[model samples]
Structure formats: C-alpha cells, structure tokens
Target: MQTDVPVTDRTRVRREPARGRYDRETVHGIIDAALLCHVAFRDGDSVFCIPTVCWREDGHLYIHGSNGSRMLRALLGGQQACVTVTHLDGLVLARAAFNHSMNYRSVVVLGAFEAVPDDRKAASLDRLMDHLAPGRKHEARPGDANELRSTTVLRIALDEASAKLRTGGPQDDEADLSLDVWAGVLPLAVHALPPVPEPGITRSMPDGLRKWAGA
Candidate 1:
C-alpha cells in the first residue's frame, strides 16, 4: 500500500481546495494516464516551463532529454521543481455562461530532480519503453554508448504531490435552469490512429504496434 504524499504549500490547490486530493492513488493515476508533463523551474532570475515526455516508475516520475538541453541541465541543480500533468476529459456546458467550466484531471508534483547514474540510466529508460509499449524494447535496437552518453535521465520522488480533478456534468444555478441555452458535457479522449509503416520496411506490424492500435 502506498502512502499519500503530504501536501506542501507548493503542491496545494488553492483555487478550489475541495477538488484537491493528496492520496497516492489519485496522484499515481493521473501520472500514469498522462504522456506529457510541464516542468517548471527557476534559472537565474527567470523561470521556465518546458513540456516533455514522462513516465512513472515506482515512486518516481522519470524524464529524459539531450544532455545539452537547458531544461534538463537546470533541473539537475538540486533546486525544487514543479511538474504538472493535466487531462481535459470534457467541456462542461452550463445554462449560465459564468458556470461553464472544463472537466479535467490534473496533478502537481514538487521535488528536486536527481540524475540517474550512467550504469542505471539504460535500465531506467527501459521502464519508459515498457510504459510506451510493452515488448517494444525487444523489437527496437538498443542505444549505443555514444547515444546514451548524449542523453540525460532524471527523476523526482512523488513524495510531495497532489492531484486535483473535476468530473461529471455542469453545475448550473437553480435560477439558470430556465435559460434557453443548452447544457451538457462534451466528452473528450486521446484517440490513437492507425499506424503508418515505413515505406522500405518488409516487416509486418509487430504485436506491440497491434496492441497500441487496439488490435
């Protein structure tokens, strides 16, 4: 059983405290369901927020990028960083315009990142491959020493994270119930399109691709 991360000032959802959840289940669920995260960090006198691919491995959220990337370099300084992931599930239409809002699941993590050692980087990155597509690591060619050397892998513990979510339909005022405007939810999701094969490839779609395509 995973314990809930204690909420800190940074991870606290001030706008609507009722929507915030500090449970591990909610945080992990939001992280696992997302393919992208925006990392916010301070650099010199300025702050930067960068979008990158991310994956969850046990108690950590992992991210990788070129060694030359400024964002990655900035995160390695042991400074506290903020990472956020959001999924827009739907648009809640209300009879009153003021009551209109978006249905979304969002997570906020506040922690300092640490670099994965050279020896552990490969194995750590394998988790990312497995997360993206099971069995894909076996089908894909392994990265060479130079390739690995040019990449940087970092992770932050999920010890100070919180999740905020809004679900269900619109909440219109009783007075607005008689309004002429339509009121309902417009649901949304990330759809996976069919795969496109390489022109010169003689191989058929692999099992992993088939699974990704919902075959």
Candidate 2:
C-alpha cells in the first residue's frame, strides 16, 4: 500500500503505500539486523551502488569508508543517495507454481548525504563500534589520532523513505487449490553461534563472554 505522503520524484513508483510509519519502524528493524547496506547514487552520469557498514543514531544513518574512496568522496560532496536494506525470511511455495514468492522485508531511504566533521569523528566511531558489537568497543584499544583522520564518515537523514514487506503462505489462484503440492511457507532464520576464544589462557574471562568458552 502507498501512503498519502507525497513521494519523492525519484522513488514514487517504488514507494509502498504509507500507513503512519513513514516506514520508520520497518526501516529501522532491517537496518539493525544487518551492518552492511547498499547505497545507490549517481556521480555525474554514472550510477553506483556500493556496500558498506553503517550505524543508526537518532533519526540519521552513518556510513563509513576510506577518505580517498570515490563513492565516499561523492557522497561527501552532498550527492543524493538511496540506501537500502533487505532480509529474506522464508520461501513461500504455492499450490500452483505461478503464485510463488519469497517472504521478505525491505526498506529504501533517499537523502542528500554529507560528511561528518573531523571534530565529531570520535563519537561517530564509538557509535559504529557499538552498532557492530554492543560493549565490545570498551574492550578494544582506543583509536589513535592518525587512524581516525584516515576514515570518512557520511551521514544520511532518515526521511523520505519507504518500506515493502511480504509474508505468510503463497497466494494461489482459486482454480489451482486442488493441485497436489506442499503449499506453505518454509521458514528461515539466523542464529548466532557462540564466539570462539583466542589460544592464550592466562587471566579470567569476562562473564559476558562465558558462552564463547563453552561454559
């Protein structure tokens, strides 16, 4: 369903019907589930979609890469970009082959991206680390001044976006209801295995990581 919110001229067709979410909740969930997002944008006459790690804070998304990278440079120059996140949930098999589709959740966001200032780099890096592994940043070595200067971070405001989702069993035609087939949704999921520990065994391990040691 498409929402009443006026669609951005660039993504009007792809925009799902707005239903009060402004697609924020749905978009946030997909973004949190995966660290990598594909950002699409045009540089001059060429369109590019690059995959990179990102984090969400307040109502904005932060994406990072090398300062010298072309994509990062273009985005830093205030180019319009479309960032997308998707997760495949299951395979929906219908009674008839024609109506088969996969269960999925996806979100697409459009924004004019810009680079974060050097003064804000430290806080941004901390947020990025926590996004990847909560509490892990405090356990690792702090970033040296030189290392921080080499990275480029772009910020994209979380407005002007839409989300599309499909779920449940497949939609089969009435005429094909009698066909003999296993017609249902085959569920799929992701589960995290315990972490692996390093070889040295001298000091007591943190209680938070007990499971990783087979405890």
Candidate 3:
C-alpha cells in the first residue's frame, strides 16, 4: 500500500542525498527484513530510544514491552514517538576518508502511540511472533493471563511513515580520485548459522529448520 508520508523537497534531511528512497515498496521491504525496531519518544524533557521487537500488520506497526517499563508507560501516556528500523548491509570503505559510508535501508515513523486494548493484546502478541518467526506462534506456548498482564502492547499506524535507503559504491570527490588507496564497500549480510536446538527440548528440528541449518 502507498504510504501518506509527504516527500516535500524541503523536508528531506540533507545527509546522504542518494540514499533517500520515498517509494513505499522499498521501504516496506526493508521493514519486513528486520525483526527489531528502535522507538524514540519524549518523556517530560528527556528523549528515550528503546529497542524492541516489532511487527507490521494491516498497515500498522505493533511493539510491546514490559508493562512497568518507563518507555512503555510514557508511550501509554500518549506521547509522540519516532520509531525507526535499520539494516546495515555493508561498510563503505572509501579511498578518501570523507567519502566513507555504508549501505543501509531504514524507515522512520513519527506518530502518536496508543495503548492497545486488552481484547486485542493477545492477537497483537501473535502478530509480533509471526513477524519474527512465521508459523511458530501456533507451535509455541501461548501467553497466560499473568504474562499478558505484565506486558504493554502499543500500535502505531503506518500512515505517516518515511523510508530512506542507501546502496552502491562510494562517492569520492574528483580531487580524491587520484588517491592511491583501495576504496570500495565491504558488503555484509546476515548469515544463518546452524540451528542449535535447546538442550532439553529436541523433538528433531523441523525439516525446514534443519535444511536451514544444513542438517
């Protein structure tokens, strides 16, 4: 779905000019690949950024944490927040130090957060798990009333979201082109490791997971 995030010429933050992408597809693709988000919100005079698991469903993003956390409590108080998710693909090592950079995809959402009602909390939790590990929610233990009571789920509508991305080689200045130095990005990606089954809980890892682990 197309986002309502405005891409006014003046509103663009001037840093990495080529890195900014306004297209929703590119933005959402990045969000889907990452499992964590950093939510920044202000409480009184202080600004706090908290890292937490997030899930996107029906054009809204959901995040949860301990009910007693000051960050969640502050968000429940109806504070405006900036939630961001970023994935660093590689380090851009340039011949010139000034041209050094990194390839990344990131999304920034600014909105007013609200406390999800109790009725939808369980479903929200399910979405979060599915976001992190699809189909695993049904296979795992469901949260009990006590566990639910200790958690706070907050939802932020994806209406006002903006995504920016950077890729490709380093951009060295014309003058710096003459420098005798190796200059290129060292590409990086998340490599899946062999699944180490929980010591006491092994029912033969699922085939799909075993394949992922080269079992």
Task: For each of the candidates, give the backbone clash count.
Answer: 0, 6, 0
Regions of candidate 1 where Cα sits further than 4 Å from its true position: 1-3, 210-215
Model 2 per-residue lDDT tens digits across residues 61-153: 889888899898888778778998777889999988788888877767888897789999889999887876667678879788988999888
Please report, in order, the local distance difference test score of every candidate based on alpha carbons: 0.88, 0.75, 0.78
- Largest lDDT belongs to which candidate? 1
Model with the higher TM-score, candidate 1 or 3: 1
lDDT score of residue 154 within candidate 3: 90
Sum up the clashes in candidate 3.
Answer: 0
| Candidate 1 C-alpha lDDT tens digits along 1-215 | 23378877877789988888988888998998778999999999999999999999989999999999999998999998999999999999999889999999999898899999999999988888887878888888988899999999999999999899999899998998998998999998877686677899878777664444531
Candidate 1 residue pairs in clash (backbone atoms < 3 Å): none
Task: Indicate which candidate wins on TM-score.
Answer: 1
Candidate 3 lDDT by residue in tens digits, 1-215: 23345665432546756556666676677777777899998888988888988877777778888988998888888877889999888999888887898887888877888888998999989887676556768888999999999989998976677777778999888988888999888988876686677779768655433322321
**Model 2 segments beyond 4 Å from truth?**
1-21, 201-215
Off by over 4 Å in 3: 1-4, 8-11, 207-215
Task: Pick the winner on lDDT between candidates 1 and 2.
Answer: 1
